[model samples]
Target: MKIIVDRFISDSESTISHISVDQRFVCFGLEDEFRAIKVLKETRIPAGTYKVALRTRGKHHQQYIERFKDIQHEGMLEVLEVPGFTDILIHCGNTHTDTEGCLLVGTSAHTDPENMSVSSSSIAYRKLYPLVVGAAKNGSLSITLEDNDR
Candidate 1:
């Protein structure tokens, strides 16, 4: 499976991207602001292609299953071998604050009334988790991140 994230909407606080699997739309994604210097929990992961897998062991795995009970399967989708980053996963959230250098999946993107940034999350994750898990089972999953602004 090949997942592509085209980051198109960006602001000082957050960046929003359209996610697709093999040319099929999947969801919107949220990440933290881009930074020239990496800042813990506040910078987006560097754009690149990375291997993805189902991670069964870890706090994120347990937390995801707890929040989304329907995800009773095995593991959370994890992005592997990102240089200078660790534990980067495609999970659930509404805003940049929810991402600590990780990707957040959402159904739609809208400016947050309070923050002037994008939100509307969780529902997309509910829809996406199962599809990604199924893809992982079939073969290796890889994701490519591209900054459309560039």
Candidate 2:
């Protein structure tokens, strides 16, 4: 699986981006503000490529199992080997407040930099988790984060 995140909006508190898989549009993405100097959980991961893996153990994984019981929930779709980052999973959420340097997926996105957010997050995640997990299990899965200035 080739996941691509195109970050287009950046603000003091959040960043808004679009996520695609193998050249196909998938969902909207939200993450903490991108910073040159890291500020613990308030900074987004740098623009680079990272492999994806199935993280079976973690707080996210445990909660996801119950939250996504109706879907084929296996493990958290984790982006591995992110420089200076760990447990970077592609999961569901509404805004930067819902994440800590991790990517959140949603069906709809708002580009207001001051209050960037995504909606229908769980709906989007249910559709996304399986595809990512399947690819990770089958073979190599990777992602590229690119910054597109607006």
Candidate 3:
């Protein structure tokens, strides 16, 4: 499986890393717009087609352990599954003003010293995560982000 994120298109100063495998696509924590953490044995994901899955615990994610009780009951911290139509992703932003509900990268625009203001974790989640997750889950061998420089 291959995962790609474009920094130019991302909100500045985001930290992305740590990808995990569930039942479908490889899941990851979004570090930055240009960085993606993919789960595979190889250092680089081969360019091809593959499927994707998103492992989300839901809105009560802070109560993650209780949210996905079954997974947690089994002693697992992260929940794994295809995102389906939901735009849940381990992305940038915090639980405050910066997040707008999606996973965050920087604490917030004010917190990030680099002055990255255009990217929204929620927006990025809406625009990018689904497409990548969809491709990965549907059996697309390779996942690519064109880096639109948004």
**Best-performing candidate as measured by TM-score:** 2
lDDT of 1 by residue, 24-88 (tens): 99888888878989898888988999988888888878887777787665787888898888888
**Per the 3 Å backbone cut-off, how many clashing residue pairs does candidate 2 have?**
0
| Stretch of 10 with least lDDT, candidate 2 | 130-139
Candidate 2 is scored at a TM of: 0.95
Q: Where does candidate 2 stray beyond 4 Å?
A: none
Per-residue alpha-carbon lDDT of candidate 3 for residues 1-150, written as tens digits (9 for 90 to 100) = 455432233344433322222224332333333224532211122222233444444553445345334433212111123232123334444423343223343312332434434334444333334445444445552434333344
- Candidate 2 per-residue lDDT, tens place, 31-150, comes to 998788888778888899999888899898899899999986888888888778887888888888888888999999887758889999999998777667788987578999999943
Against the reference, the lDDT scores of all candidates come to 0.80, 0.86, 0.34
Instruction: Provide the global lDDT of candidate 1 against the true structure.
Output: 0.80
Give the winner by lDDT: 1 or 3: 1
Model 2, residue 124: distance off in Å is 0.8
TM-score of 1: 0.88
How do all models score by TM-score?
0.88, 0.95, 0.30
Off by over 4 Å in 3: 6-52, 56-89, 92-118, 139-150
